[model samples]
Target: MSSVPQPPRWDVHRLPRARGRNFLVTGGNAGIGYFVAEQLAGTGATVVLGSRDRAKAEAAIGSIGSRVPGARVKHMPLDLADLDSLKASVDALGLDRLDAVVLNAGVALDRPPRRATGDGHELMFGTNHLGHFALTNHLAPLLTATPGSRIVTTGSFAAKSERLDLDDLQSTHDYRPKRAYARSKLAQMLFALELDRRLRAAGSTTLSVLVHPGGALDSLTPSRPPLHVRTTGERLSRLPLGLLVQGKDAAAWPAVQAVLDPSVHGGRMLSPRAFGLRGAPRIEPLWSHLADTTTAARLWTASRDLTGHDPTFTAPARSGGTEGPAAGPGEADASTG
Candidate 1:
């Protein structure tokens, strides 16, 4: 009798070569985003760091170059808080094709009297959820144009427990900073799932996948000189914490895997395996709250209204896919909240 064959296990250190691909990572200048960019750069693909600060982006690029010789990486200015500039920012990429874009940039306020974006929406909600929503709308054409392209939205474990109050999606009624931040992330996660549904309905090849970094701590992260440097003492002290959590570099695995893994499919979510807290990336069931299509549809309508962009996406005609027109915000399913 033939022996049973086992599936190959994913190895984070060994990524498939992507010599001709193009990838964009928003907020790739620091933290988990920086590590994601660096790891992607190792695959011999061109990586663009979408950042607001030129200086910081340059530092990140330099650090990646230092770590990975001949790394092809550059910067594109993106201010997610400024809704007006996102389209122009996308236009600036000037790429003929984009293989994947990691929507990882975000704003998290630890303590606040509460703040609003330039467009007057709550800061966290506007930048984290709405900003990516609008950016995806603008990039829809390019994404659909590229064969087998992906839009990877990096959500947060912090969102697991929160519920969306559709009446006040921006946290106008109740504004604790941490809770508001979690809500914003929850909105992003919901949007990813809904987008996947719409894309599948339209027969598009472009995929939208979701991921969350488990608990990541700066103290556990390795040093990337000129960008981030973890002192020896800090590493020694945080070593024990690594048993429960992980460093920012390790936290980046789920998003990276989503971008590169062939088996990953749209609408599926990847998270850490160790109690959703720390371990290698693995496919996980969507949380019950995330499965609420009603909430997602309503949030989609609100996002369209707030951003003035309808994200009804479709594949290019050449791809043997039909195009769909943008739906009116009020035209959301009657069954939706």
Candidate 2:
């Protein structure tokens, strides 16, 4: 009998060349998102860091340049808390064909006195889930136009124990900082899976992949200077924890793999290999809660209504212009956030 062949093991240190390809990472100015942008930049891809802070974005760009000589990276202003601004932000990307987008930006509030977004939705849920939802819909044209494009949604390990109350997605009735943040991430994960299902149904080429950083600690992470710095003592102190939890850099592997790995299919989830914590990234089975299609579909509907943007997977007809499609209204100023 023939043995089943295993897929090639992914090496986080070595990545495939993606010259001329364009990719975006939301919140790439810091944390796991920053590492994701840096890794992609090493692949010779044009990496855009979606951030709301120009100063932080520039600093991150400089940090990547310092580490990876000749790195191609820039920042696009993005405010996930402002739903009305998402469409304009997508337009500012100025790329004719977008290869992939990493939905990784989020706001995790730990203190009391629950806050809301500009649109009046809970801060975590609105910015983390709904904002990405609207942004994806707005970028649908570019994604579908580019063959084999992907949307990689970064979820969280905290989401494992939390369940979403679809009726109160905004956490209006019951509000807890950690619980709200976890549910928001759960919603984002569910959206990624449901999106793949919808894409398949529509016969679209764009793929939606989900991923989560297991346990990322700044103390365990290597420094990138201006963006992030770890002292020798800090590293030594966190060395023991490295056995279980990893740094943000390692946490970025799964998302990067989802973007560049040809074998990675839509609707799949990737995570750390060692008990879903501090090892290299590997494919993981979707949690039982994430497999509930009924919940996902309902959440999708609610998202569409709240964002007022329906994602259509259809690709637009290719135009003759070499620079890609012309910018839509309010897209003329790429520098404006």
Q: List the residue pairs that clash in candidate 2.
A: none
TM-score of 2: 0.92
Q: What are the models' TM-scores?
A: 0.92, 0.92
Write one digit per residue (lDDT tens) for candidate 2, span 1-337: 9999875566777777776788999999999999999998887788999999999999999998887878989989999989888888888888878889999999999988989998999999999999999999988988988877899999999999988898899988889999999999999999999999999998887899999999999999999988888999999988999999999999998999898877889999999999999788888999999999999999999999998987879644556753422221112121100
| Candidate 1: clashing pairs of residues | none
Cα-based lDDT at residue 278, candidate 1: 93
Model 1 spans with C-alpha error above 4 angstroms: 1-7, 319-337
Model 1, residue 287: distance off in Å is 0.8
lDDT of 2 at 282: 87
In model 1, what lDDT does residue 68 have? 81
TM-score of 1: 0.92
